[model samples]
Target: MYATFPDLLRLLFVPALAWAAYHDLRVRRVPNELWYPFAALGLALLAWEYVLVERTSLFLVRAAVSLLVIPLAYLFWFVGGFGGADFKAFCVVALLYPTYPSYYLADLALPLVRTQLGVFSVTVVTNAMLASLGYPLALGLRNALAGVVSKLMFVGRPVAVRQLAAAHGSLLETPEGFSRGGLDLDALRMYLRWRGVTLGRLLAQPERYRDPATVPAETNDPGDGSVTTEPIPDPASEPAPREDADEYDDPWGAARFLDDIDSTAYGTTPRKLREGLDVITSQERVWITPGVPFIVPLFVGLLLALTAGDLLFALMRLIGLV
Candidate 1:
């Protein structure tokens, strides 16, 4: 565990970053607002290493890996292989867990017990051991931990998980965790007013009801709030509400849609999905093709492999029975 600290540093940071990335993706835009704090966090990690630890390799390696992962991460995001922000967060994570190879390639040059491949041997064995113990082992461990935490906290009512089943127009039965952001009517209106969407119609078809979360569910409308009665049908009832369904599928289908067709050299409109890529070369300059010399190789290439190898040695050296 002590030896795993450096890798853990990365493990802790990237998931937090990835969460932000997922939020940015949902909005179909990355917020410029978030960039500053993370940049500072990255800087702080470096500063701490220099000022406190004096291990320049830790600072330098972390910093260098962080910087290097960005472009490749972006490329993965661009190609739709991952969310833009997920790629960004994962790049940093790669630095954290060289053995995990978070966002990059394994060191092909150094294989055997000297690189990540070697370290993975331990992970495989450990996971196998866990599997052998079976589901009961994990459940027992979790229940035990939860019981301890509850005891320390002085157990109250278990927090109810609320879900708002605002499926129908009038009878919006909020699940345990559902709410309309108070009596704010504007939030509902925002969904109704969103441009290009037949939201009102979708509203008529409550089955197609989206989360109050599509946009900020806030409002200036002051009233007791609207009301009615009826459960909204499941959104799937329609001929697959084209808008909501296509939002992701459309983009993804773009690649597969063209996979069957042979494009003419004479400037045939290759379709929208095909448009994201440059058609000049058959090479994957866009989504779908795992571009050669991927970001992982360039970023954490050597370190990742070594970390893996070390894990195996650690088992042999540390975990071996005396």
Candidate 2:
């Protein structure tokens, strides 16, 4: 679809909401002031899409759904981890994003993630529909043709006995050209040729196959049998325990995790007083936020929109009007 004014408005709300959610998920809190960017963007888009455009009919419908849904989504959140900011965010989005295309009825409204997660469960039925009406089996047809061709081939006459004997015995000869020397029969057997092919030298001539290059270093069984096939190092296999995985590489990481930001910051690397803009811009410790999910006030204005959208979506589905 074209990047209409409405679509452009919707795009404004995504990045800030995504960032807010990232921090909220990380630190369990979102800063109170962080909601401004999202609010400003969303309001601007809403004005453009709703006030300046011709989506008035859809607008009226969403307004009504908004009144009914705004309360319920917040209720579910307040009693749980969902905070006020997240609740409000959902409410705003419900009024905006979900208004497009009457999303509830469209065949492609939901994507694969939703489909896997049990939204619009017609997936299996669709696949079965294809299977029942699709092409006939291919394997049985191809094999039947091969069998017919094999039966039509003529057999050739047998060769002389001496020629056959030499073909079979040529595999055992090697350099020193001595017919063999200090022969390790195991290596010889391992390298044996088949179908008149030398099996790549060693199989053809064990006498010449003793070099380290030709005979892989590993193929040489350990002298004292100290290493009797130390299980093939499979790349798919888990590696031997990592050295750093067990070591305490970070001197202060553990302390930071348990302490609050202010407490941890006291012990953090102090800012360098260098006149050249200090070696680093800032080095706040992770103990408090450790990352963003661990941060507190884990709510953003858009969260309210997501839930409001979800519930608005669910209720619409219930009434078959979404």
Candidate 3:
């Protein structure tokens, strides 16, 4: 049996999304350039479909779907729920498949389930969200089996301070308390490298560096207090205000390093760094959440959206809602 134009177009997403998922998993980044060709192809296909379609009403529905998805994707990104790459991917998907593609395997129709809405991208987003729930569930189960019974078990796992640098995640435990916005480990490593000290070295004698005034000088300094040879910005003349300064004197000794680096570049802030350092230096084990990128689930969601239709819609139907 010959495949339809829409079917061929839909198949294109399989490899494209697979590559994106792999890239996101490996580096947690997806270059904007990767989507350029796909975007162009999608626009061309949409134009071609517009010129060839006999049903004006159906064409309008497709156009509406594409229009609706753009802002929705942007909103997700704006609220920090989705990354910029994830937003671009959804936009490309909207352009490519505004409605569910009509595909078949021999005598069987693909997407065994269907929804009245028929917006393919929305289905993909929903399916991806549902699939992402598995991460927490798996974490919870693993923690349970390991005899750990804490609410945090569902979100994070404990890692030794020495291994924290190599781990891929954000710090959940902090000196102050628990934080929803976990500290960025990459930022911590960046700061450590800037200081010419290893995590182990810092933890071995945290008290030695507890007072920023007495902390050892940076290795990169020329000992003449010159900024010419400095790798990063010079540390601030005065450290950031410490809430507990009167109670405890720079417990982590990390306050002096905050102003020296660009926090935005590392996706962290001074407060997070200060608190995270206190936890890292003072404790042997810390909790960290494996920050899974959304693209992975987006890929799985796309596959399920194409093969099984909207899982949520099917669930609603099973419960006789539609």
Candidate 4:
């Protein structure tokens, strides 16, 4: 048996985990190209151990345990529990480390630490899941210190109608206490599709957005509550009408974009700036979902699994509960 080769195995497993973590952190996805090769290599290595090294029993048992876990991972992804990349990463882990490698966690003295786990990848995932559970506490502490605890705690908070047009990760409220889907980026993207604007464009060049006065008006249907597809002339493009005053300043000004945010899903009305001016001007905040990317905690779990074995098992031993 190649006892020294475990160090080489660490080199194999850790690098792929690190690389996937990097891309997942950056773009919220890890490409299939990364995991696919690693998965194939893992299977090949397992095959070599079984056929060439003559460790048939160990190889079969390890592979069997890992294979059983795959369906559960797929089910999680199917139910929207996690992303595709996370599920694939688990599969790759199963292939790479079906059992605990001889080189890893050699110094740990915990009685519960197994030399070889039923499925080593399951331990890694369990550790990762436990690590992710701590994230909310971390976020709560961060928001508390930042003095946004009240805003963060509430599911929704009142914000100015003006801020609604530019808000991210937050929702807007109609005066009658219904929510507009401000945080729902998908719906907003659909709404912006007709304007030839993508989310990237909105983020990059918000100033280039069409003037609110120029947006084509839609006729409201009282029956089905659908807006009719009626094209209207852009008022800004029309010739100036004769007036007694030399200049008339629009009180609403740039905030006219707020009117377009009304959604049929919630049956929300376009809230006026004046209605919530008191709360908006004073609090100057809105409700936010405060979502964290799953990859960060997954990376942390990988590190802990390498050095600390199973986190819940370790904790049980520490408190003498086992």
Instruction: Write candidate 2's Cα lDDT for 1-322 as tens digits.
Output: 2346555555555575667666555433456676565556545655665667746775655545544445765775655434455665555454444343212223433221221122111222223223323122232344355552222112111122222211211111122222211122211221221111122322233222222122222222212111122332212221222233433332212222223122221122211111001111111110000111211221232332222323334445679784
lDDT tens digits, residue span 1-322, model 3 = 4467766866876898899889777666777898888788778877777777634787768568766888988997887776778889888888877767777778878788878877777888899999999989999999999998887999998888898756766899777677767777766666655555566766886654454554445432312111122344443332433334444444444555555544452456667777787788878788898777888888999899888999999999999999
Whose TM-score is greatest here? Answer: 3
Q: Per-residue lDDT of 1-322 in model 4, one digit per residue for the tens?
A: 2344533564576767777777665544466788777778878777776777747776687778877767888898777566678888778777776766544246544223543355666777778889877866776666667676553443433343344433433344333443533333222322443333333443443323323332334422222111223332222232223334333232211233334444331222223332232223334454544334455676677677666667777677779886
Instruction: Give residue 109's lDDT in candidate 1 (0 to 100).
Output: 27
TM-scores of all predicted structures: 0.30, 0.31, 0.81, 0.60
The parts of candidate 4 lying over 4 Å away from their true place are 1-7, 54-58, 104-112, 115-117, 151-195, 198-285
Top-down TM-score ranking: 3, 4, 2, 1
Ten residues in a row with the worst lDDT in model 4?
219-228
Better of 3 and 4 by lDDT: 3
Query: Judged by lDDT against the true structure, how good is candidate 4?
Result: 0.52
Predicted structure 1, TM vs. truth: 0.30
Worst 10 residues of 1 by lDDT: 163-172
* lDDT tens digits, residue span 91-163, model 1: 4443333233222234342223442232322332333233334333443455466663322122111221110
- In model 3, the Cα lDDT at residue 66 comes to 64
C-alpha-based local distance difference test score of model 2? 0.32
Could you tell me which residue pairs clash in candidate 3? none
For residue 216, model 3's alpha carbon misses the true position, in angstroms, by 9.5
